[model samples]
Target chain A: MNKRILFAVIITVILCGLAQAKTTITWWQFWTDPNIKPVIEKMVTEFEQANPDIDIQLTDLTWANGHEKIVIAFGSKTGPDIVELGSDWIAEFAANNLLMDMSTQVASDSADYEGWGMATYDGKVFARPWILGTRVLFANRDLLTQAGYKENFIPLTFEQLNEATKKIQALSPSIYGWGSNAPEKHRLYKKFLPFFWSHGAKLFSDDGSMCLLASDSSIKALKVYKELHDSCGFVADQRGIEDAFLEGKIGFIISGDWLLKRIELENRKINLLSSFIPGTKLLGKSFQGGEFLAVNTASKHPREAMRFIQFITSPENQVKFCVANRSANPSSLEAQKDDYFSSSIHLQTFIRQIKFANHPPVDPDWVYIEQAIEEAVENALFRSGLVAHSLYEARKKIEKIKAQ
Target chain B: MKWSKAGALALALPWLLTFGIFWLFPIIYSFIIGFTDQQLLAADTQWVGFDNYRALLSDPDFLKSLKNTFIFVLGTIPLTTVIALGMALLIDKQFPGRGLFRSGFFLPSITSMVVIALIFTNLYQRGGYIALLSEMIGLSPPEHGFLYSGETALFSIMAMDVWMAVGYYMLIFLAGLKSIPRELYESAEINGAGKIRQFFSITLPLLKPVALFILVVNSIKSFQVFVEIFVMTKGKFETSTMVYFIYETGLTTKFEFGYASAAAYVLFVIIGVFALAQFLLFRRKQVAW
Candidate 1:
């Protein structure tokens, strides 16, 4: 009896140790959307289930906090085993040497991953493209109708939008014809980026030498932006876009699909429609504002981490991510063709916009420049009360940054 | 023989070492970086000498932010001092519900500034209550509260800060007021001094130390105002302050540690000069008695 009990005790100890044996992976992310959280949690669970030897912990932080937190973490050499980086963050993080080159891991089978090139730096891949969605004009058709604009009056060009806005303002029933956030960097930059690019303006000069903000095309783009603000009634704060649209007071908003679930949740009787915003000088230009999954250079289990990223980016799993979160599919050639995504009519507009995204200027200076430019632009508008001064001032500020 | 000094030093060693390694090194290192062309990821940093300082001297944004910081500090400190003293005097009374009122006053200061800024943002929105109230009163209320107006945005933030801080500062004043001997006031009454005269002669004179202490602390904190502008207008609407400028310069873009470090050192010097001037002026008054 004593011998048997000893053997059982030894067996139990071994089993317990096996249960505890796992490579713990730390992932930091910020997904506040109610739909997004569960989808991600499910993905994490499935990844864990498949690899019982690998344990993964997920943390959810807000967007603004996440930006600061990730930067601090990387600077301190204690970020995460993997992190979800916003598309805008690529330039900043890539510039800092915080991200690892994923090239070696995927070089053997690089074709398996699609658009992973988005995270490339100096010809080396760092992160896998996670999701793809673009900025679009959200037209509340009911609001348009109330404002005496036709249902099809969603403008096909910047000129058309202005014209439509003027018409709506004339017969408006407390409903403005158009609205866009002037002070928002992420939103405005993305919306204006395409216009600036298509209008033969490079936001940054070739070889990334100067801000080129004084370039004539950029000035024209700024003028167009000012016109949007002056012609379309701009709500001072962001909530004006979401609230006024819900109340059917705003005809159009330059926003993304991030608002879709909220609109559905509110259950407002207004007709919410999404479409590609017409370009000022070219085919509709949009920005892909999505997160990327990059493995930590400090990760103890790089092979396993890389494999996880690969598995997740697979067409099979990406569908899981997008469908569960109600987000656009990641920029995967395979994922784009998935019947589940292609058949979804509501998602088509976002999907179609994927091609037009002017790959963001990949420079280490973007995060700081973004903040400086945003502040400069807003001050020029609200403080100096002049667009030319604001853009020029913004250009000068960016120039100082670039020269550094 | 000097065990007390040794003991104190021993106890302080932990904090001293912590501050030395963490704060001192960074401060000095950043100052050195200020003299060079500092870039985080780049290995090369050519020495730039005083050029960064020279450029900063002429930078409008830097000057604007500095000006904004001073305006915010000036706008809040006096009002906070007087209002806090008034509240402290009221709370020192044995009046009914005094405890509740004290707690209520301290409530906003206890709440996070981020939450307050967020709530304030909503309040300042168009057709929001604050805006509506201004309109109803026939005021040319900035349609976006004070945040949208170039003329009033900075002051508006200062006003919110003062409102948030008065309660906290009041508690400090209340403590100082309580510590004062009641016998002194009684003697003043016996001497036939009026309430106003008694206040001027005793209360104001006695509260000098506390007032000076509050002024120094408030000035230092207000000088470093970043989050309010960062959150409210993101340093937009003419509300950008010195610290926010430092943040944008240093950590945010290209990590221009050199330029940002220069800006920071300038800020330190400005604060030091102000504090020193105040000390010299106040010390000459010889009011310790």
Candidate 2:
């Protein structure tokens, strides 16, 4: 009887031990795509199999409210162990000391990711770059052909683009020449930055102290934007521009790679083509932006979070995630050489444009500065305000924000 | 056993505690925060003591938002009240398909605001249904879209709001109409009074309280409009209402908690003053009548 009791007690102890051995890592991510969720779930399952003692608890956040949720979670000191942050959000979270310093973990291959600049703050790596994205010019080939353009013709210079837009406009009264984004605060800067960069304009000084929006280059860029608006007119927003292009109502548009994937999924046959943005003297550049994975400073299991980040950012995994999304480029330089990217002409153009892609300044106060730039662009384009004067006003506003 | 004070207190304790914790504490805390310089991401806060409020007074964006909100309120309330009253009158009569008409009108109010805003956004596009209809009717539509043009964007949103809100207010008016004595209309008709005269003499006077209630409620709602602006134009094209500005300041852009709190308090005061003024105006009119 005593031997039987001992055996039962030992079995109970072993069961409790097994239950207590596993540690749960709460992961909050913002990938809302139904297709991407299964991919991430499979990855999590693989990671759990590899690390038997760790379990991942995944929570999906909506893109519309994800940033606000993260802010609130960190403010209340109840954030998850791991979070998927936008590249631009790293500086804000790091400045608040809410993100763990992943400097040592990321030190080895930090140079391999082009988007590392956005994930670094104060010379310290706080996040692991996962995806890379850049926008390129997309043209409606049917509209171009209707406007008397040659087959497969792509505009490579600002002058040619301008002339092509006019021809497209003259083709039909209902059609527009260019599909451009309206002055939306969150995305307007992204739409305008390429033009600003191509005209040799700098957003800030080397040390990021002074605003250079009123510079001659910036004014020149604004004038070019104004000219485009006068000729083609701006769409209500990015989605409006995409819809206009999809409907064959617009000849030219600059958009992210997501549109290409969307066209493929919908089986849209509008003779759409992609190319680098038009430039005057140099190759057109666009915004380099993406998502990163970061460890919350308040996490109980920082090491496990770091492991998960590493697992997700591994070259093979990165390629898998990017391929599943069908829009984002892999942050891994090795993954960029994958056959999937090489086989597609659409992906090839984006890869080439990514070479000239530039990221916005990784400052905590960049949101305010971006608003100032958006306001300046809006005033120049819609209000018919003088470009130099609008830029000068924006400079004053940005200086005030910087002073604060 | 008869309830005693202590017994009542015990029963009310749960609700009172919830109210105190969830409602009262946040209000007081936010009010206190309004007097300080607090960034949500900053580690430390300083007691700035009305500096943020002072800044808002001189801030152009705040002023514009205030103006826009006032315009929205003025633009929506009267139209919504009149149309709601008209709809209530039309539906109150016994007619065939009355129930269907009533439900059809109320459908928009029952539908999700986000969905309605999105649908309206599409309709306001350059070649969307509204624009196409306008062009067919020999009216020149805006070159871009209704939402793309600064001149018409706010008005377009106001029109949609009125359409969406009239139904709910019409239901309220219907309730008010139901409470009135039908015999008064019968007596007036027997005295040779026309339908218009009876409506003006009996219906309008009796519905005074309901009208006041609708006016005050609609005004407050119009001033607090945010979701439509958020989903439709995102406060672009001069559609930045006061609430949208506060949302942008507090949540979206800089997370300037202190300044946003100050702005919010200012909006609260404006709403309170308006409500009080409306009550006084209507009460006096009622007493005189």
The TM-score, computed over Cα atoms with residue i paired to residue i, of candidate 1 is 0.84
lDDT of 1 by residue, B133-235 (tens): 8888888777445677777778878888999999999998988887778888999899999999988888877877777788888888899998888888777
The TM-score obtained for chain B by all candidates, in the order given, is: 0.93, 0.96
Best by TM-score: 2
lDDT of 1: 0.75
Tens-place lDDT per residue, model 2, A58-82, is 9999987898898888887889999
lDDT of 1 by residue, A1-404 (tens): 99999999999999999888999888888776776678778778888998888888888778656776776677667889888888777766766666787878777756744555467777888887877777767877765676576666657787877777766666654657667564764555665566666566776766777777767877776677666666656555565677777777777777766676566667767687777767764466776666788887777888888877776677777887777666765666677777766665557777777666666666676765666556645654455446566667778778887775
Off by over 4 Å in 2: A1-20, B87-104, B174-202, B287-289
lDDT tens per residue, model 2, B129-161 = 999999999998887779877888999999999
Model 2 chain A lDDT-worst window of ten: A232-241
